[model samples]
Target: MPSPRPSLTLTLLQARETAMRFFRPQLNLHDLTEQQWRVIRILRQQGELENHQLARLACILKPSMSGVLARLQRDGLVGRRRMLEDQRRVLVSLTEQGEQCFASMSLEMEKNYQRIQQQMGEEKLATLLELLRELRGVKP
Candidate 1:
């Protein structure tokens, strides 16, 4: 017998792709992968963070985060340094150029967000966001 309901995991992934379609062009233009942008966005908002903290907030695995940070550092978008007080801890921060890139890209990103809001209606979008947050809090 066929299940009547769609797979929730697959549906969520599809929904993410649909949303990403709006912003992927800006990312491509900036030569940033999704992980790189997520790291930059978090660092821009949170200031310097320990490497593990950054990976957690960015939802990127530790192994993959090393490559993402390397690419960003190579492009002069990010910097990494060992904490002076805690020699074993590494901190990551965005460079000046990274901030400038974020500022420029944010305009386009905001416009795309506004377009999505307009298409969906502000109230519904807000409700959807709240619902998504609640859903994320669910556990098996």
Candidate 2:
């Protein structure tokens, strides 16, 4: 008889899908895609960053970041300005609308986090975080 393969990959995939279910509804309320929301959240936490920096912070590729910036600019949620020292370099920042949207969405995101934490409890949550960090080769 063949032994069962490890289920870690399946568990990770399922967890990701479940988390998206929680995120999708909140994102839809703000008319934001998951990638867009990720960008906004990264900006909120990291402050202003250039396009390439933002892409790195958001874990997205440069081409996708370009599209996200275009959409954000078109929606008046983000603004860009040439760097004073280097005209070729562009700095990106959130507009008033973007800040306001992030503030609202942040609350929603917090609530989701809290709900999960409560469901899992502190011990399990800590273990989960430790496991995830180890998986990513990050020391806890």
Predicted model with the maximum lDDT = 1
Q: Give the C-alpha miss distance for residue 47 in model 1, angstroms.
A: 1.2
Give the per-residue lDDT of model 2 (tens digit) for 1-140. 99998798899999988878877889999999888888888877787899889988787899988999999889988889999999988988888999999988888888888888898898998999898978988456
Give the runs in model 1 whose Cα sits over 4 Å from its true position.
Answer: 1-4
Q: List the residue pairs that clash in candidate 1.
A: none
Q: Which ten residues in a row have the lowest lDDT in candidate 1?
A: 2-11
Count of clashing pairs, candidate 1: 0
Candidate models: Cα lDDT each: 0.94, 0.87
Kindly list the per-residue Cα lDDT of model 1 for residues 5-95, writing each as its tens digit: 9888899899889889999999999988999999999999999999999999999999999999999999999999998898999999999
Q: Which is the leading candidate under TM-score?
A: 1
Model 2 regions lying over 4 Å from their true place:
1-10, 138-140
